[model samples]
Target chain A: MGAMSTESDPLSVHDQVVRSTYACIARFGMAKTTVEDVVRESGLSRATIYRHFPGGRDELLREAVAWQIGEFFIRLADHVEGSADLVELLDRGIEFARQAVREHALLQRMLVTEPDRLLGLLSTESTKTLPFIAAYLLPHLERARAAGDLRPGVDPVDASDHLSRLVLSYIGARGVVDLDDPAQRRDLVTRELLAGILRP
Target chain B: MTPEASPDVRARLLDATFVCLARVGIAKTSVDDIAREAGISRATLYRHFGGKAELLEALGQRELTRLDAVFAAAVQDCATVGAACSVLVVEGAEFLLDHPVLGTILAIEPTAITPLLSLGHADAFLTAAAALVAPHLAAHVDDDAARLRGAELLVRITLSHLQSPNPQRSITDPQVAQAIVDQYIVPGFVGKSAIERIQA
Candidate 1:
């Protein structure tokens, strides 16, 4: 996927833009990152970048969002499927997520360079970035419910929403949990959240 | 039109109004104090802003104008609808969270915002904030149910964030509050939508 996309794919242009954009994001974060930076980093002309991304910066971010979502699912699905128990699976998955949180270009940028901007992306009701969380987690949560593993009569949807919100609430509360301290905050949140939700 | 209605008199009175409001707050602030702050006769202060309600309304407008400018500046660099919406709330929220006087009023003395000036009241504030945010959530435009649900969640989350007792604290702290903005609020909204698609 990488070589083909970079070399000959029709989306080579698009891929280049994403690469350039994220590289800028990696270095400067969303606030300081710019179309010029993406172009400069990609060695693509401004015209080429605009050619690939019509909405420009926002479009690039949206694509970046989709790209991130794809990567998140790849890791999350692997984590989910590798284990049988939802609790254990989620525990592992949460660790993966925590690692993602610590290392994620977007999350890292938001946390370090532009917390105000990041919180906006995260807290806004309809932003694509935040909802991807629910979409990714919902299916498996429902599966847990169907298997009679979740608390009875608890709306699986509500429960899933609760889980994400719970994470967001805590994660959003900066200075509370050490985001980079993977073993500490990540494990505890998953454990405590699961403790209350597991069928008892 | 009249000597009693000079611009200098009006400006002096307005400044005094805020000075009194700042030192004592709306409830305890009195017209006499405003006059003192302005170095004017008590009768002169009333001449500019008639009663408490009128005085408060003017002050609130000034604050809203400042907030509006802040909102505009925050989004000046944003490119897409989602970025704009998300950034507005995230940045605005942080500002609301840390703003000393405003934060104190919101967290400790919310009565100041309750009837919220008829013009820039809570509903109006949400509506404008929602408008600012609605662009990013546009994907849900076709999904009214999801959009509305998301909007409701957004409103609740924003209010909860504003009302949060300690913004700088962590979840692990012993004195952590019972109400969690993300744990309960965000999931309740985002998760519900995700669960709905699954249950469907």
Candidate 2:
């Protein structure tokens, strides 16, 4: 196959590598997403990947994860921005969150096998989504408050961090979902989210 | 194996668990710990509470009940959604930190952190906390959405803070943390009351 880059290549050589890495992850996850798999999926030789990325598979995965993180955040922000009500904002947010937790095989692998290490990742900014939660929502809270929609005294920024960590916790539930009925488990999560704040 | 006897035995075992927790903490406080602390034989402890998991749930349930009482009190006077929520969330955090038992639990058994972080049963705490917020939110506020989302965020950040090697231990000021939260999170819920209210 011969394709020209002309100006905008929707998927680049690097992009293909990243995508292939993720494809392998989809099949074998972060641990098993080998260079051979990437090479086979990508139609690129292992030598070529090594030439580009000396660090090999871990480096490829790091980039893949970083790219995935950015894309996921963008989508999540769009969901948050689309809603007005506090409840709705969180609802959409959780939906995106559920999807992320359900789909991200690598994150799940880390959560299951290496929680403390994952927690350490959360503690720092290398791969944390916590830092962005407030930054994403502060504008909306301010806008809502001015519109008299937001109740008095709610600190939007602190609330964001507070909420970010909470959602992460939900997404990180260990083996409970994999071992149980996935849909029923998801419903239980949805129920907990809604029921947790329902008025008596 | 009868349900009635099982629960009673579970209760007695959990009560004994508190003594073990107080003395050794959750990690070191194994099945033997409960047995020895309760003056019950090891076999009896196993009969009621299968192992660490069951012991943890029993303890978590007890702790949730304790939190429910304080949380209900904190938000009792919330006239607006903001007041009802802020007061409740902060008070809830305070209660979590105040309970040496919880601290002991976390310190003793770090993985147990997952129960609150990942499991659905913890919604009891979320619901109790939301009782404070439900009144102040817009009448149309989605209870299901808000509680679920809020709990998700709240659980992660609160646990992170608690588990932090050194969280903001000495600021003695919510305002500082509030500023962080506002610059970061509030705008999503209230459109700009915090920023707009300032007279130029």
- Give the best candidate by DockQ: 2
Model 1 error, position A102 (Å): 3.0
Query: What DockQ class does candidate 2 belong to?
Result: incorrect
> What local lDDT score does residue B7 receive in model 1, on the 0 to 100 scale?
82
Query: What TM-score fits each model?
Result: 0.44, 0.48
TM-score of chain A of 1: 0.63
Query: Residue A178, candidate 2: how far off, in angstroms?
Result: 24
Q: TM-score for the first chain of model 2? A: 0.58
Candidate 2 Cα lDDT to native:
0.55
Best by TM-score: 2
